[model samples]
Target: IDPRKTETAEIASAHHFIVPGSDAYLLLAMLQLMFERDWVNAGHLAPLLQGVETVRELVAPFTLALAQERTGISAAVIEAMTEKLVQTPRAVFYGRMGVSVQEYGALCQWAIQLINLLAGNVDVVGGALVPNSAAGYVKPGERGAGHFNRFQSRVSGLPEFGGELPATVMAEEMLTPGEGQIRAMLTLAGNPVLSAPSGQQLDQAFEGLDFMVSMDIYINETTRHADYILPPTSALEHDHYDFAFHRLAVRNTARYNEPVFEPEAGALHDWEILNQLSQKLGDHKGIDVKMFPAPSAIVDQSLQQGPYGKHNQRGDDALDLAALREHPHGIDLGPLTPSLPQRLCNEEKNIRLVWQGIADDIERLRIASPPQQQGKLLLIGRRHVRSNNSWMHNSHRLVKGKPRWRCLMNSKDMHEHKLADGDDIVISSRAGEVQTEVEQSDDVMPGVVCLPHGWG
Candidate 1:
């Protein structure tokens, strides 16, 4: 379910057109039905589940009619979807990037997981089983309490997740001067001016910094303001590892990618440049980059310390960098097996359905007014096939055709606004405005429009 008919929707057997930021409400309504109809089947999970009663109470006020009013979807459709989820054992609820970045993102994500738990679709085959990842975090009886709202940002008082504050608050933190004010800035691997919410605001905030440095290969929008740019080896010149992605899979696999090209003499990789910077910053006399371990050495040591590693010895045969290198196509360790109470992160070894901090937002959702879409169209962001989030568009072969950045508007809205297909218009929000050409299409939901990312 999404605000737009995305490419994924084209292949889906059905698509549910939900309002831009009302996903949490729809999810709560479905959950309400699950409780009222006695459809929740957490058979084996009963002993390990907590807060079932609290979650039921939390969602009680959100009815199908209320959800229909907030979301553009119908009450009957909501009921049918809930029934399907409870009846299908293999069906799981997953929230993606779009929902996770909305105003009610945290609530929507929590609701989705709670729904999956109630449906008994977790940890079983074809369900939501956790992978036996390269890391040892998912072992039985291990505490996996991933950090959340542990601390707040200095200026906005916004909560930090995993030690980093939200990018939305970056400009404000830099622009608002006082104690702990930001005077110098450093950027790595991102062009926030084009990819972040308040692109123009961030661009202005960069102007006031005393010094700024960027670590990137291309001098794009955000990096253009930096006092210095540290160029690194291109993609082909670096060894590759999927440190961020393998943990999300259902099958455990490992692959080490060798660099495609030899590095030019005296050309430093990213880590090498950072090591040199560190030495200079610390004023360490005679410290050399040779003192540090190479990136591959660190990876190799980490692999040996993993569950299948010879040093770890948690499993039978030894698996390490050598084992991975023996098979070029990549070796599948095994399918993810069920790891329940052992995988629970809490001291009690249970999964709590209700988090009071997140549940508190349910009431705010109950009374919140539907978005005002009368004189305005909500803007949604999309990525072009030829470009990633602010990357890969520099290649002429990928950008040789017509301009990929255009405001996609529903044809009905174009008719009411008296706009031709190719008319140039200025799109405005409180943060900033951009003038771009409009393309009429039925793919976008009415009262909503889209713009492609990665374009300056």
Candidate 2:
């Protein structure tokens, strides 16, 4: 956990959070605890934070016991963690990929942000800071809601990057017939079929697409569905500047990688390949300027703007093209300043903790009082940094032999299911079922089960 992103000096003065699988249940408990003990920092709240009163009223019924029952976490532990979170002056709550790929993934992400808001960490230093990369731009682009929010998936209503969501919906779009049925797809450095929900269903959906293209190194699970595959050069062959990673980096640091190999006669770099593709695609219709700006023009302008560029230095930014050329390793920007009074992509120049879309969805889920299923094993996914999926399975160093695949069932649940460790058992959900070997571990909660991803 990076302190720069998690430290806030407002409500609780401390930072804390729970693991992914436990988020939904534990977060509700934290909110309930805050309300129960009057831990909510009412004085620190912004006026636009909606449903605070409604949330207070709603959490009344969800007592500690109820939370423990739903989430399989002990009430005593939840109480302790809640207290720790509120006791410190600058704390942040953080969750990443682990929390964003489940059934309640979005809800969990929203909840983490809510906790940060309730703690008054928004916009403060040592708290989650917004990106300052906007200052480094040339020609000063008008920054506001661009045309990126209008386009959505024809089937599942997923928004595009400009308006469409992640290409995870590529499979669903293929099977669903309507406007924008997705006759073709262009995949870049992604494998959705194995990594996305309902992989089997996604596999079938890809068959429906008229054409599929992939820009990748090796043909993996998703690439098998493509009509044409464009193999790009390996990482070593290209110079690297991680623009996105910089904005998201916890600490202010910069590093650049130089190409190890000299350019061959006809070989193109990734940027060159992308630029050529954009020109062929015509007009940059669905492309974002941030991603595909006219490289030559941008470079020329950047050269004129000086090293740090026009955005960061206002024509005085120390960074200029000559400096960059001299120092190819990159320059560190150093620790960022506290952005407590600054706006982070917000129109009002403040964080929108409880936005309209999120607040409305929470309210709907609150009123539904949906039925909970029994005898269902919660299947959670796990992976190591060394390997992402079956694509890396062939690497002997990463995966020795079929990854240690098994459903981590608590010893108590193991007995309840009349199952033994290493026994073949059928794990089923309402949607479907698969046979997985069982591995009993005391670390798993009584009702919870852990499953390694990419069984196929």
Candidate 3:
């Protein structure tokens, strides 16, 4: 975790790709090397692999020079990182809050997956093991023509996750005049305006929405715009199970925490609210809907339809919540099952890296109108340990030591602009502009700026 630590016994070599804002480009560069050098073990990938040639072709344009330019990373540094991966033991590459919220967020995520796959580090010891939790291994929802393979938003047709796009377009969907424009929004555990793209634009868009509903624990920026705010119980009030991270950890470990206190006031559990809203929306309120059903039902349903469904043909009914809870924390799922040869999505056993449609989208952006050359600063979002999204923003202890939000600038860049640290500055992006106090930090490279989320 320390940047100062040299590549060592536990670590081999560490290289930082100054590819500040975009994680996808950095990943492409690494994948390009794996293909070009034949470092990937083809045999290791069995029936669960799909679309290898497509991936290779997609990454072809992201040569060292191109990536360096696109990501602001030095080619030499990228190459050095590749070298370290080739020489290190248990060398694991990771990225967290940094790449998850960006203009090209999904691409960044995909690229990280590609790097892990090519390096043969997935689900392996000291590698990028899928973290599992006591929530049980229930797969995500199904992917279909209406789902995966298609983009829905007007400006950016980002691929859908769980039958929906990035949720970045929620505000816009309601504002843009159209027949299919969103008339209602149901946000479950998300704050789009603070976490999504085009913050200024989104703010304007929210004002135009007919009905905005928020299911959250606390009232914050985005929720303040809602017509109805449904409060959900805080983490301490509910049983905790991290279903997503369990599959990604090196060693399977599970921890269970019983509710610290009984539900007080009118605060309802998150799952209960989600179920209530879904039934009301689906117009089937009379029938009971188990939002978070038994793990077996979830696993069976997901395996039968989700992206991983086809791969796991003969699933057992034994995998359920009772089974998971039997061990209290969780049962270690062990190493990742094989994936290369068999296609997880396609019937054929191959890897489809290109995702032609995604490639086309990026290509369009490349050729699209360039960002305005105005002096506005590029806006970026950062996360903190205090809360997720805008749920607990009012916590006095959390916001007391820091500005609710910050405008981070490279010291050199600040000096060049003749702007002093702590001075209020107007930041303008193609989306719009906002005023925030500036803070100088050497952590960010010159010419770039960062802003913490949860502040207007």
Which candidate gets the maximum lDDT versus the true structure? 1
Expressed as tens digits, the lDDT of each residue in 1-456 for candidate 1 is: 988899999998999878788888898998899999998877677789888888889899999998998898999999998898889868888878888888888888888887888888877777788887664435545544568788888798998887788999999889998998888998987889888878888899998899999999888888999999999888899887677677787699887888899988887888888887887866666544344678778767767777778766656567777667777677788988878877676678888776667767887887787776778888888888877665766677877789788889999999999999889989877877888999999899899898887554
Q: Candidate 2's error at 181, in angstroms?
A: 2.7
Error of 2 at 456 (Å): 2.1
**What C-alpha lDDT do the candidate models reach, one value each?**
0.83, 0.63, 0.61
TM-score of 2: 0.77
Once model 3 is optimally superposed onto the true structure by TM-score, how far is the C-alpha of residue 374 displaced, in angstroms? Answer: 9.4
Tens digits of lDDT, candidate 3, 1-456: 211111231363443425345556667787787788777652254234566777777777667876676666688777777767755666566766567655666677777777776676664566664433323343334244234735567645655665666656766676777667877666766766776777766777776778888887767656778899888787787776554665455554544445788899877787667776767856754665546663345544432443223344425533444444566655554555433232233444355555665677556534544345255445556544564455566677665675656677877788889989789988765567778999887665565676666666
Worst 10-residue lDDT window for candidate 2 reads 1-10
Give the Å error, residue 39, model 1. Answer: 0.7
How far in Å is the alpha carbon of 341 misplaced in model 1? Answer: 1.8
| Cand. 1 Cα-lDDT | 0.83
TM-score of 1: 0.94
| C-alpha TM-scores of all predictions | 0.94, 0.77, 0.73
